[model samples]
Target: MMNCQFVFLLLVIYMLYLFVGAAIFSVLEQPYEEQLREKVLNMWDDFLEIHPCLSEEKLEDFLRTALLVKSFGVSVLRNISGFEVKWDFVSSLFFAGTTLTTIGYGHPFPISLSGKVFCVFYCLIGIPFTLSLLSIVAQKLTIFLRDRPLHYFHHRWNTSNNKLEWIHAIVVISILCLFSFFIPAIFFNFLEENWGYADALYFCFISLSTVGLGDYVPGERSGQRLPALYKLLVVGYLLLGLVCVFLMVEIFKNLLKHNQILSLFLLGYEAGRQDEEIDHVSTNDSEVPFAPRNDETTRRRVTHSASPNEKSYGSISPSRAPAIIT
Candidate 1:
């Protein structure tokens, strides 16, 4: 009976996913990005008006938007979960690639109440799985990044010592930090007049971290239309940035376990101790020969035992007397 009930619940969820999820997936497409933003913003405003405790200024409007977008975006990914792309194997690969990166960009979303619930549930479960999966993929990508021509400078200049791993890690991280955090931020500051560099940095960090605080997004400058190509590019960049961070963390972990520095320190200390012991042994060699000493009583006992054990003491008394006389 319990099994039947479980199966029934699952069936309902599956059906809910099919119709409602498809609706949300379709509605969440790039065409609706602005609309969703506006709706969420208006809702946010109303929320603050109702509860003055919810301060709008402190929260910052941009961060609010990023959160909403991320929430909706995650919902969209969850809604479309398990839907396979069929536009040939190649196109399908592209679709799968985009979905995992959270770049749904309107290709999919959720509709009905059940679907929305499912989406929320799915994301709750799926996001971690998605992250783990992406991490594996990023590890593979890191190998390629490390082999790039410029990496040679990092690898060669760093010493043969264990600290070299950290040096290499720092180099890789510097490249990622500059491109993902600094470069985008600089561009944003130029494009959006009056926006502070801090805000730009904040935006870059939020986006790259996938926190999508929305408080400071790019292309939100005055009179700017959110360009489709730009949005797509931003999504891709964020994904790559995250991958870079993961790779850096992984490399750092590997360096810690490398054991080169620790082993060298331990072995070097041990060798020094051994050398001192050897020197002491050489000095002592002239003072005494290495041999055991026996007392006179022990030596006497050995000599007596070797003398053929006169009369083999355990015989009868009469036999013993006869031997003595002989």
Candidate 2:
């Protein structure tokens, strides 16, 4: 019952956050967007005025067609040499990888009927595969980045579990953030001439978070060298970054467990059985049947457990073998 109430509160908070973000973005961006819209309208009127013999309907159709072409990732920026080839083999390969990864910069999407249909089917199958891949990697990295170091520190330093967990969280978050976000942003800053460090950092955050706002995509600049290679690198970075994010999320959940209020988000539930797979080392106390340390509730819970022959998730078989369980 308490968990349900907590979940409800979190939902309310989330909705509030969304509305606040919407209001803030509107305030920040709306005026500029309106100004741009007016400027474009004026440009259209001026162009029509300069070419009075041109039919207004024809001009409107042409404008719409140009916009549609750009929307479909076709470069409508024509010069004497013709528009850039955006759908060539390398570009298409990059587009396919981005689509599969769900980074989807929104610059190069399928325009054709068959291509769009294929895209829908491709994503239907591929997104799950991508997520599964990330999960698998996160599990492995959890062992390397989280488990081994934490185990060593706790055992060697004789540190308390609470302090060790906090240290673990801080260390893991720092190292992963450096590699996944900060380092990538540095590279992006150097590679993308128009991007400032802040812009590059924003791009890294947006891409790795899979928000893909498309406002700050790299390798899209005209005269960009080795655009295909750059896109492939971005896709690779996204996969590694996602794995780090997954590991960070586990740390986030672990830290949340320490906080009585925030712990409700987990609702004392995990996706799968926690007891069966892991053994020997300290497990989440949340998995324990009830509080066992000296207290009225603990005493009652112990009596209840003994009466019911309750099984604890901890490794040891239960008959009040707390040390063995840990």
Candidate 3:
């Protein structure tokens, strides 16, 4: 129950964080977006003025063809306005977050030497911080599911421990898939004009996995103005999607822990146990006396025994064996 509350609180804080970032990004990027739009319009007007003999319809067709050719790398005309936007505070913040999370969408990047240097240092600190934050969230989410939801299912079904564990894993995975991928994909398909259901689903999968192929970013589509509300919603979706993905991974790890066949694929299990045993033996050997070897030359033998209260080391000598026993 406490874990559930902690997850809830963390989610609330994360949503607020997304909203703050979205607000700042929208504010900083809006001017550049408008400037890019104006520049495109001015370029079109200049082209029309230069070619007065060309009809409006013909000019439109030519411009569309040019854009298509440019998109396909069949033309020399580069989209200069696209690269004119500065990496302002909000853009830098969002990029840094994405970088730390390993979701390099590649829509924006550092072009300057100083920015690249800063990026290197920023990631050194930020990646670990992001990973630790994700780990904590995943842990709390696991505890929450186990204590509240799984506990209820266990009692209600009167199931065995193994079955209950599997049931818990299934329930958590179903919820995560529904919220993180299916539902969000539906929303992304609706919001993104060019995206189909499959494309949206792929985007969600890639983004959650931090593969971030950059082919289908949420915003920044051409000729589309992202409203502040939509931007906030997208940011919220990203945060919640990441949480669900981490939660699913945590539940899957727990399931693997209970499955002998599957657990073998996990590396270093026995090696880790052996390392722990070596440490324990070393610590014990420091406090205990060495036992004598069993050899014909040494008529005395030593045996070591340990109990809850104390440990005893006894030596048996052939000459004094009777007295030693007493």
**Number of the top TM-score candidate:** 2
| Candidate RMSDs in order | 21.0, 9.9, 15.0
Which of candidates 2 and 3 is the stronger one according to TM-score?
2
TM, every model: 0.41, 0.75, 0.61
For candidate 2, the per-residue lDDT at 309 reads 60
What is the Å distance of residue 213 in model 1 from its true position? 2.7
What would the per-residue lDDT of candidate 2 be over residues 129-237, giving only the tens digit for each residue?
9888888888887788777888998999999887898988998799999999898889999999999999999998888787888898677777777777787787778
Query: What C-alpha lDDT does candidate 3 achieve relative to the native structure?
Result: 0.71
Residue 88 accuracy (lDDT) in model 1: 34
Against the reference, the lDDT scores of all candidates come to: 0.59, 0.77, 0.71
Ranking of all candidate structures by their TM-score, best first: 2, 3, 1
lDDT of 2 at 202: 96
What lDDT score is found at residue 43 in candidate 2?
95
Give the TM-score (vs. native) of candidate 2: 0.75
Q: Flag the better candidate by lDDT, 2 or 3.
A: 2
Order the candidates by lDDT, highest first: 2, 3, 1
Better of 1 and 3 by lDDT: 3
